[model samples]
Target chain A: MHSFFGKQLPVAVAFFSGVLMIITFFSGDQTVADFSQEQLVWVTIVGGFSLLLGVASITRVSLSDVRKRRKGWPYKAVLLIFLVASSLGAIIEGTERGTLYDWLFQNMNAPMMSTMFSLLAFYIASAAYRAFRARTVEATILLITATIVMLGRVPLGELIYGKLPEITDWIMNYPNLSVQRGIIIGAALGAASMSLRIILGIERTYLGRQ
Target chain B: MNHDIVLFLEMTLAGFLTLCIFSFLYKDNPFYRLAEHIFAGLSAGYYVGLIWHSVIMQQLWVPITQNGQYSLILPGLLGVLMFTRLVDRLSFLSRVSIAFVVGNTAGISIIQQLHGFVLPQLGDTMSRFGQEFWGPLIILIGVVSTLIYFYFSKEHKGALGITAKVGTVFIMVSFGAHFGYTVMGRVSLLIGRVQFLFVDWVHSFNKIIN
Candidate 1:
């Protein structure tokens, strides 16, 4: 009974949701379509609420760490304060233009996030130098294709070889597009299978317990 | 002179922070640790604000009032149910909320899969021997070989193996191309940061001479 209600119930919901959504795409009924759209919004709202659960968990864990004076307790305290302050600011001031919350978002958050993203360049370069090697048939092909694409993408390559643009277009349109498409199809099938397993209670990792 | 001093201070601090991160290449050091901890705190605070403003405010508060209180009631209930994770005795109730969330997500994913993945690929495959035969032929080979390479149940010892080997080449070339492009992108990002530091934060040589 527990398995059926607790675990399988999610699975059943997953299965039915999938089927209904698929049907709604082709369904003629306006009411059915509207209901499906609203249901999706509700699901999104529920997901938003899950964030609160996360915030709550973070608060509990970080406060405990601070109380214990763990190695990074001060940092945790800073994080908690930031989280609470930002959340409260947004709620009270609202997120409209010219608000303090919006200003912080534009100046501090965007630049910092962009900085972190840009840091990836250094990491990727280091990784490539250490890892990229043409040890096998596949690796060799990859190396060659990568070279062509790189050359074709930039104006320098075209200047070096006037025909580079035509060749790059050919590679991207044919082989690249086809292989990417096949992978997409295969992955979709795999996802469907996994969703089915979860709905049926054959998979329960999401439940976060045995 | 006053504005110059303020700019100098901000520029100095930003430069120091950037270098602290770069120091990671040499080895993990105290400077790196300090910078990392500071970034972690700032980013957490920023993200919490983002989630509150972009998601919670837009999806929940506006909808509750602008749309109707009735519209938000069920979602609120479901959101509250997620907090069952906190209560040891009533944790089972959380499953109801999870089921709804999972079910709705699975449903949308299934529909999107067909639209976004299946149809696009089918169009490509069906359009084979298209306007350009050479382009279509290469794509055909790429699709076939990549599929064979991914066929895990079979052994690649015969003619089938050779084809799979060929497929691996194509995939590798594609990856190499992607890697090179990524490197170039990172270099550009670094350049952008340097430009901002130099141009925005400091005067040109002409202004200094004046």
Candidate 2:
């Protein structure tokens, strides 16, 4: 009974849902299309509920830490307080655009996210300096290409060389585009095969087992 | 009470949070940790609110109640079933919900990947061949050679080895170009932060002083 409900039922459900979606894409019938679209909406709603699982997990972890008086438990407490306060504020306000929710997002969340991302610039610069050594032919080509693209992308390149932008454009349009296209095709094919595997029930990894 | 005063306060708070996040570059400290925790909690709360309002209320609840689409109740039930994973005996029930998501995504992606990515990219690559001489030839060589490099079924030797080597060069150049572009993007983000600090915050301060 466990295997019947756990393994077989789930696989059947997945196969049915997947086939319906594919049918929706190909079928010209408005009724079928609408039904499929509605089903997709249900999938999205189900996906959204998964977020609650995450929140629950976090809450459980934080509460356990607080109870244990763990190191950095104070920070965990602060996190939980903010989490509860912000959620309550949003729920009470009934809209994210409401005063407290909007303010917290704009003042706290946005700035931190932007600043954290911006810090990557410094890290990338340091990494490039360390990693982009001209050791071999391949490395030298990479270094040269990186230098050209970097210089051509900014005003400094034009200040040094008049034709840098033109060369950069040529490289981007031809060789870069070709390689990008190759990669796209390869990745698309790979993804399609994986999707097929899932649909055919050959891939049961999603069921939490090999 | 004034709008300008409100704006100034918001900008000041944002700038302070931004600086706190940036302080991580010096070393991990109390200020950075506070900002990080606040950001995480607030963002998670915001997402929860958003999912409830936008997805659940708009898509599921409204359709079921207002439109009398009672069929949606099934998927909603499936979504609720996802929580059964917390229970030892009923944990298998969660597989049904996951199956729906996996199947739906796979079905949708298969056709979209083929139509949107694979075919168009191949067509574009082939179409470019007759348009120009050297440019197209170079692109063709790059694409073919790069594809060969990615083909791991046959071991590289003799002619295949040289082709794979050429493919490696193209791949390296492509990677370098991508890295350079990413650096430029990150630098631009950093520039935006600097501008916000120096221009917007400073100007606001001057306005208050005046």
Candidate 3:
């Protein structure tokens, strides 16, 4: 029963959906397309529920910590309070504009997230300084190209050299496009093959072992 | 006066959160951790709000009640089933929902990756051949060489080794450009936060005094 539910059942479902998608894609039948479209929407709806699992887990962990009076328990308490506040606020008031949820998001979540991300600006430049030492030919090329691209992006590069922007554009259009395309093709092929494996029930990793 | 006070309070909270995050630059402290916890909890809560409004209400509830789209109920049931993972005996049933999502995603992505991405990119690369000779030539070399570098079936020796070397140079340049762009993005976000602090937050003080 365990094996069936855990592995065989999941794989069988994967196979069915995978085959259905492939058929719908190539069939050129309107009915098939409509059916797949419905299936896709259903999948997205299911995707939404996946986040609830995270909520349950975070709540469980934080509750346990608070119960235990762990170190930094005050922070966990704050987190729980805010979590309940935002989720309940949204549930009661709805998520439309001018709601408490929106206000919380606009004031608290947005600025905090942006500031956290912006901190990486300080760290990444410092990191590049420490890491990009031009130790070899590849390193040297990377350093020079990075410097040129960075400079070209800012107003200072154009002020320093009139042609810097053009050189940056040329590099981006040619070399960057080529390498990115190569990477994309390679990744696409990999993903396709992986999808095939999953559809065939050859890839069982998604089903956690009992 | 009340509305102005509310606005002022909001501005002050946002600025405080912004400063809390930036305090990480000096070192991790109580304020940073408080902001970090708020970020985690608020993001999760925001997602809950979004899913409730966007997915449950819009996708399922309205569609069923208003449009008589009874088909949506199946996905709603499947989504609800995801909560059963909390109970050990019924936990296995959650895999059924997971299977549906995973299968559908894998099935769709195969074609999306191949037809949507690979075919278009390959066509674009080939189509560029009729343009100015050197630019296209350089791109072609970069693509082919980069692909060869990724290929690991055969040992890199002699001619293959040399080609792979050229591939590395292109890859490095592309990587550098990517790095430069990422830094620029982070810096721009940092500038926005700084602008908010100076132009918005500090300006509010003047309003209060006036």
lDDT of 3 by residue, B31-81 (tens): 999999998889888888888888988999999999999989998998998
Worst ten-residue run, lDDT, model 3 chain B?
B1-10
Lowest lDDT sum, 10 consecutive residues, model 3 chain A, at A201-210
Better of 2 and 3 by DockQ: 3
Q: Tell me the alpha-carbon RMSD of every candidate.
A: 3.5, 1.7, 1.6
In the range A8-42, model 3's lDDT, one tens digit per residue, is 78889889988899999889999989988888999
DockQ of each two-chain model: 0.47, 0.74, 0.79
lDDT of 1 by residue, A149-189 (tens): 77888899999999987888877776677677667777876
Across all candidates, the chain A TM-score values are: 0.85, 0.94, 0.96
lDDT of 1 at B119: 75
Q: Give DockQ: model 1.
A: 0.47
Task: Summarize candidate 1's per-residue lDDT along B1-210 as a digit string, tens digits.
Answer: 665564456455666666676667678887766666555544555556666766566777777788875777787788888989877767766776887887666666766777777777767776867576877777777777877888888789898999988787667655666666777788778777667557754553324445
In candidate 2, the residue pairs with backbone N, CA or C atoms under 3 Å apart (3 or more residues apart, or in different chains) clash, namely none
TM-score of each model's chain B: 0.77, 0.93, 0.92
Residue B40 of model 2: what lDDT?
A: 76
Candidate 3 DockQ, CA atoms: 0.79
Model 1 chain B: worst 10 consecutive residues (lDDT sum): B200-209
